[model samples]
Target chain A: MTDLKLALQEQAEDVDKVLDDLLLEPEGPEAQVVKAMRYSALGGGKRVRPFLVMASSRLFGVSEASALRVAAALEMVHCYSLIHDDLPAMDDDDLRRGRPTCHIEYDEATAILAGDALLTLAFEVLADEETHPSPSVRCALVSELAKASGMNGMVGGQMIDLMAETRELGIPEITRLQRLKTGALIVFACKAGAILGKAKDIKMQALRNYGHDLGLAFQIADDLLDVEASEEETGKKVGKDAERGKATFVSLLGVERAREQAHMLSEQACRHLDVFDRDTELLRAMAQYVVNRRS
Target chain B: MTDLKLALQEQAEDVDKVLDDLLLEPEGPEAQVVKAMRYSALGGGKRVRPFLVMASSRLFGVSEASALRVAAALEMVHCYSLIHDDLPAMDDDDLRRGRPTCHIEYDEATAILAGDALLTLAFEVLADEETHPSPSVRCALVSELAKASGMNGMVGGQMIDLMAETRELGIPEITRLQRLKTGALIVFACKAGAILGKAKDIKMQALRNYGHDLGLAFQIADDLLDVEASEEETGKKVGKDAERGKATFVSLLGVERAREQAHMLSEQACRHLDVFDRDTELLRAMAQYVVNRRS
Candidate 1:
């Protein structure tokens, strides 16, 4: 495997370990929610968000331990969103990462509570003194993460997506939806390092720009994979977007054009790294890997 | 109306105004979630949590403006929990505060999104500089609120309640469940004033003790109301615990014994206020009003 692939796997494992240590088995009747939380959060997918957090933090010479905690927190938020989105009242999916979804594995109520608890835990983790020595930095982290995942961001995007199921959306509308849905969190991950290191304005802006292009490219690639990849390759059911008549980049731009756009965005995302003198080769490699991967 | 009743009404109106101003109508496609949030949060029943926050803050001479912001945040958390708990997979209630529950007024997906957004907004509000001048204090508020509402507190209590529906729970287990579920947040509300004022250790402990007894009394009162009150009086369905065969204080202890317990606890709760000579007459009146309330 390439260096980026190895680094990604290492970071994923590190984050899993942090999450495992943070979430303890319940000794009371409420064990069911904790079990559901574990089921959804542990031993899961690519951990792409955690990888971005770690890579970005590394650029600023942040301690690996601090970065891992933030990564774990971000992953918890991401996992909670997935668990809720897959509930019977929402996407109603039975499988995720080739395993039964939280609601399918546990019960719907437990799934809901688990998702709520995970989101709560994410904020708790960020607010804790262990995340940062400075209270101001911790507050900034909390504010940024909350904004990224809250009504104006991920949740708002999900609402729009749910309403758009029966309506036909144009390319600009689809782009806006994807940006809010996935781009916001990705931007937070990339900018988190700057906040942690107290980086200057120019450097912070560079990472933000990089994250913006990379997130769009990543989503476009995901759209392409949904159109072309099989369940075995993707570890998830494919073509559901088409079956549900969901408007995606692939559906709007065609396979060839969508792929070209993703590639162009990935290259543009790499150009943002020119502002940093340190080794950003791994980040550049990630941009290419995100667009090129089958899943 | 009595002094306590008048004070409660005034505080409720203040919290409603704050919540209304904070939650803006959406200008985008995601208006559905924002509408659901407003539906559940605005013009609701007695703002009990907000009242507790304001009353507690008053002990420390915390500014009403600052206290109101914290109260509004706590109410948002309470509202979010109600929205989620009333979902079909959970309590399955049709009515809340004399109107349809969030899911009944809106779609299930919108309700879930609204709940998620409300929870997120609670943290964002607490983290903002407007909530507190010191970042450390804001961080403390966030940490306390998160712990009170997360897996080991309210969410954990909810899980136990869900599981206990199929199992028999004794009085001790029930007390523990209630303490975790509802008592935690109440205690936080009471202690928030101390934290904001940076009260002395003895004073903080006294307030915490007061909160503990008062929360239990409040829960008992709620259980009694569920057994005795009408739909119109409570603004919700009555006798749900008995209908579901869920164990509660009223079910374990006879109605007469439960009422006696609440009265005893209320008196005991007021004794903890002896450490302060700052005209705690309102808090003493609140204790009596809580147990004697018809709804």
Candidate 2:
């Protein structure tokens, strides 16, 4: 395997460990919801957002423990979104990450409660002193995470997405939708390190710029994968975007143009890291990995 | 109106204004979710949790603006729970506070997104500096709110509630469930004042004791209403627990016993407030109001 692949695998294992620690199953009937939380949040995904958090934090020489806490919190939020999105009322998918979806594995009520608990847990983790010694930093983490995942961010994007399913969307509308739905969380994952390290404004801006381009490139690649890849490789139901008649970058730009755009965006994202004097090879490789990977 | 009733009415109107300002509809397709949030969170309910936050804060001389922000955040959390609880997979109620429930007002997808947004916004409000000048206080608010509402608190209580639909629960199980579900957030609301003022540990414990009993009294009264009250008076469909064959304080205890229990709990709750040597007529009256109110 390539160095990027090895690094990604290592980080995923590390994150899985932390996630395990944070989500201990308690002794109660409510343990059912926590069980669902563990099922959906563990043993899956590439941990892309976590990778962004750690790689960006590296630039500021942030402690591994602090970065990992934030990374796990972000991942919990991401997993919660996936659980909710896959509900029968939403995407209605049976499979997620090659296993039954949360609603499918557990009952719909349990799935809903699990997702709610996970989202709430993410905020708790951010607010706790273990995430950061400084109260201001912890508060910043909580505020930024809430904004990225809240009304004008992920949830608002989801509202737009529900609307998009019923109407044709142009490039601008689709771009905005994708930004809020997926890009906001990714960008927050990148900027979390800046808040923790108290990085300079200019450096934080550079990281944000990099994250914006990286998020778009990642989504475009995902759009392509949904069209081209099978469920075995992607570990999720594919081509459903077209089936639902929802607009995506692949449908709007065509696969060839979309591929070119993703590659160009990936390179631009890497260039944004030049603002820092330190090594950012991992993040640069990540941008390229996002566009070039099969899944 | 009686003084207690007038106080609840005035606080309700004040909370509604704050919620109205907090939930401004932005110009975007995403505004659909915001409108749903506004519909469910504003112009509804007695704002009992907000009342607890403000009344408790009055003891510490916390600024009205600061207390109002926390009250709004807590009310937002309470409203979000109502929206989610009334979903098809949950309680599936069509009416709330004499109006169409969130899912009835908007589509299921929008309702889910709106509830999720409101919950996230609550955390955002807590984390912001406007809630308190001290980051420590802000962090405490977020942590306590998340703990009260997350897996071990409200959500966990909800999980047990879902299970209660299938099996009969005794008083011990029922009390534990109620404490986790509604009681946790109520406790958080009352203790939020102590957190804001950085009150003594002993004083905070007193408020907690007060909240614990008040929450139980409030819920037991609600159970009695479900059994004896009408839809018109309660502003919600009555007799739901009985229809679902779920165990409740009223179902387990006869009406006479339940009524006595609520009254006893109310009196005990009032006694807990004796720790403060200041005027606490509002809070004292509130405990009685919760037990005796018709709606």
Candidate 3:
């Protein structure tokens, strides 16, 4: 790994610790749900979303601690999505990040409640006095996060994915599906940090575009990994999408074509960072990291 | 229905139209997910949560329009909980409010996504400038909604219910479960509107207590109806809890005893409302309405 990559990895660890700290629920009637939420949220993962928030905020000269809450908030939503996605009703997966899924670890009802709690907690974290100092900026973050996570964003994409499972999907259809399902929150993560960091409107737009491209690239890479990675490497069952007849880039496009598409998207994503100053080496590295990472 | 009930129902219908108007998705790839969200959300049902918000705000002399978005938000979270609860892995119910459950009507993935979207949108509605004037108020509202909806609140209660499915639960355990699961949000709904209406903190606490008693009464009545009401009247399959071996008040205390308990809770809710002055007639009536409603 390059020095930038190594530094980000360290920061990623810090982000994970911070995320765990924020998710700790007070003892109460809902303590079990809180425990389930913390279990899934604190489970080991790449922390890519939080990384993006911190990295993007760094571009605008904001301290990592200043963006920490928003970073944790992004991870909370991501974790919630994963837990729900792993439910018997959704993707029906039994394992996630190399462990029994939330529903399997806890009961399905607890898993559902856990996901719900985490999603609500994300907004609560963002609305905190420390993370959101200015009402206008906080409002902007709330709107952006909502639009990205809501029906017109991540949830929408998942719906299309469900519909596409039994149907033949074209490259355009697949891209569109991934954009909403996967890309929306990644973009939102960056944009939310930018809003908190008080980046100029134009710069925020550029970072958003960067996130948008990066998100798509990440999705394409995930498709690639599903075919190439081992269970140990990906920490998930590989080739399950193809086995399930789920429409994915590699299944729709040949492996060679999918690899080429991922590269093209990564280049486009990196180009978006040109709008930012040299301090955005972190963003550029993230683009390259998306396509190159083994998992 | 009484004259007041008829008028409240008409107002609820108008509010339902507003809900439909507000939920239309701006065009994007996420439209279908938004559509499913709209389907489950706008799917015909009693707008009780919104009614509580509107009624509580009205108690404080705020116009319905001023509390319009807050009302919608309360409904959104309520709808979200219902959708998630109806999942195959959760309650596994096939129907809600006399309609096919979200997971049943629109595939499981779509239902999960729809519920997730609605939960996020609640905060979005609060944060919008169109809803309230002050960010501080919006911030408080967001925090209130989140705390009420998350672990130690609705979701937490759900976890307990799931865990206690076969295990015997006493009155205190059952009461605690119901209080967190249903009572918390209703309490927050009243408190939220009162906060938006700028009610003093002491008044807000009293209204919240009123909501708490009403919520408990509502749950006990629901437990009663599960035993007494016909499937058509209740819009839910009768004897579900009994079939599932679920512990319920009626199951624990017998039917007549459960009815008495509900009456006591409703009366307690009314006594809490004595502090609200003459304008609290509607709020008091709502408490009685909780125990008296057939469905």
Candidate 2 is graded, for docking, as: high
How high is the lDDT of residue A27 in model 3?
65
Ranking by DockQ: 2, 1, 3
lDDT of 2 by residue, A125-189 (tens): 99999999999999999999999999999999988998888788999998999899999999998
Model 3 per-residue lDDT tens digits across residues A135-166:
77777777788888877787777777777766
Q: On a 0 to 1 DockQ scale, where is model 2?
A: 0.92
Task: Evaluate residue B18 in candidate 2 and report its C-alpha lDDT on the 0 to 100 scale.
Answer: 79
Tens-place lDDT digits, model 2, residues B55-128: 99999999988999999999988888898899999888899999999989888888888889999999999999
The sequence of per-residue lDDT tens digits that candidate 1 reaches over residues A1-295 is 9998898888888898999988997899998899999999994798888988888888899888888889999999999999999998999998899898999898999999999999999999999999989899899989999999998899999998998997889999998898899999999999998888888999899999999999999999999989889898887788899999999999999999999999999999999999999869888999999999987
Q: Judging by lDDT against the true structure, name the best candidate.
A: 2
Model 1's CAPRI class?
high
Residue pairs in clash, model 2? none
Per-candidate local distance difference test: 0.91, 0.92, 0.82
Poorly placed runs, candidate 1 (over 4 Å):
none
Kindly report the docking quality category of candidate 3: medium
Judged by DockQ relative to the true structure, which candidate is superior, 1 or 2? 2
- DockQ of model 3 vs. true complex: 0.63
The regions of model 3 sitting more than 4 angstroms off are: A25-30, B25-35
Query: What 10-residue stretch in candidate 1 chain A is worst by lDDT?
Result: A43-52
In terms of lDDT, which candidate is stronger, 2 or 3?
2
TM-score, every prediction:
0.99, 0.99, 0.94
